[model samples]
Target: MSDRITIKFNAAQFLTSAPTLKHCPPDTGAEVAFAGRSNAGKSSAINTLTQQKKLARTSKTPGRTQLINFFTLGEEQTRLVDLPGYGFAKVPLEQKLEWQKHLAKYLEERKSLKGLVLVSDIRHPLQEFDRMMIQWAEDSQMPLHILLTKADKLKKGPAKNTMLDVKRALKDFQGEASVQTFSALKKEGLDQLKSRLTEWLTPDEADQAIEELIDQDSE
Candidate 1:
């Protein structure tokens, strides 16, 4: 849809946290996930996207979100996941390995995971962990929407170039992966983010909403 769908961010509420796949909530409905490096502003992006401050618990400390936290959008079936950040050097080796294992299993095996919103810092772009995530999405044939967060840190020209560069890098990927610049601090790209989430989490509803809008325009 060309027009952005209005999202009720306050509708989002904390669901549950699962340390491992076995402990996750039931795999019954469509859910989109957010993943990124520890210092990638993942939590800021989530809070900004949902229009709810402290929804995902933004922290100055990296690797603070060690669990896979779930947030539902009014409905229990529709969900948004905050995955533990990867590539944190300060975290213990054993714990880092454990997080990796859990993340890999969930990405590869979660039936309810419709798509992923891979958040990356625009300044740093794609790191090693981000490439691994891209590989996983490619192998699974899952749709991926990349968010170049902290775009405000860069000038307009550099931000645009970064988005283009990332898109080019992902061109060789087998699965669908889209890239866009985002600035949680400036509230940029919220509309686009919400629109993508709508398409992924509630495709039918999105279509119906588009149809309704078109009808209104005609009338």
Candidate 2:
């Protein structure tokens, strides 16, 4: 596979509001969205997965990414969505409500959204808000995957055990959802997360993927 299978995030268009999201092109390309609490290392994880510096900007400031960001994954024409982080610190209620409205509408209605990559803190697996979001994704039938960020902060045994605890908590949701320990700082789990993301690329873009499997089988 091409290293550019994930490309530079060439554009970060800031739509004024969620209602304007309808104006986006309705192309059939696969879309993998990333969402987590503000400052939960979403941008860093994206950068690590794509192996591109600054594809998504990391920030200590809560709620720096206040709009939906889009990027193409090179020649195969995959779409990656960087959603605005929810639950920012010290934000006004009205602004939070506005972001929530936009994000909820997009998740519930986007036809081309093939999957969602939900990032969360490894130490606290399922906060109530995260659980509610998982239920929503489950109801929407979207293929879901969890990126347990900050894995490097914990010891290996504790990290693996925490992952299992998370998986056990997800048994009810549908689709092939799985959890992977990740740390953009440590560069841990980047390759594994990228491999999981490969499953989200549009079926058409996955042709050589099938052929490669066949070649392996033939050998």
Candidate 3:
């Protein structure tokens, strides 16, 4: 375990939303995308992570968010993308296919995409589309983090079992990824989640400082 210093992430503010990759903001910096099945609490997780009540739009209806939403974290270059949810969209199949195509284009070709943050309901994890998303990350050799969202719905033991099961299933994955249980409502695993993100998003200077701290402790 790294006894690293706490690295604070700046409050994320809404940057923009685009229906297509071409309409997105310039791709010049690191970005981590949040993806999940429809109505899987992706928006709620984003809101909770940013400590804002309404940073990302939340709706009871599935597939309410039709566009790709971007939020900048302190810096203009570092971003968190809230991608349109897959599966169970009430829209026509033709429209759903369009969303899927756009999503695939962004995931496959975006130059600045650094990682993926996959959100899934703990009760129904690793669905077909979820598996596809994981495969995309693996194909790109990018790091992926799976958030088993709505963990509060399950009992503690069952949640742990689910997380373990997911992790075990990921052993066959070809690239780097991790799985964890999370609950935006109960604020469970928030610190650990943020710490994992900090490991990915920490700037060079902050990383150097952490290294120095580690060196001093060793001395």
lDDT for each candidate structure: 0.87, 0.76, 0.85
TM-score of each: 0.88, 0.81, 0.87
Task: Report the lDDT tens digits of candidate 3 across residue range 94-191.
Answer: 99889888998899888778778999999999999899899888887878999999998999999999999999999989888899999999989898
Cα-based lDDT at residue 140, candidate 2? 79
Better candidate number, 1 or 2, judged by TM-score: 1
Q: How large an RMSD does model 3 have?
A: 6.1
| Model 1 Cα lDDT, one tens digit per residue, 1-219 | 544444466699999999999999999777999999988989889888778898999777778878999999888888899999856748778888888889989999998898999999999988998998899888878899999999999999989988999988988888777888888888999888888888777656665687689889999
lDDT of 3 at 45: 90
Candidate 3: worst 10 consecutive residues by lDDT? Answer: 1-10
Clashing pairs for model 1 are none
Question: How are the candidates ranked when ordered by lDDT, highest leading?
Answer: 1, 3, 2
- Which residue pairs collide, candidate 2? none
Residue pairs with colliding backbones in model 3 are none
Residues 115-210 of candidate 2: C-alpha lDDT, one tens digit per residue = 889889898777765776688688778888999999999999999999999999988777668889999888999778777777566354466687
Top TM-score prediction, candidate number: 1
Stretches of candidate 3 off by over 4 Å are 1-10, 203-219
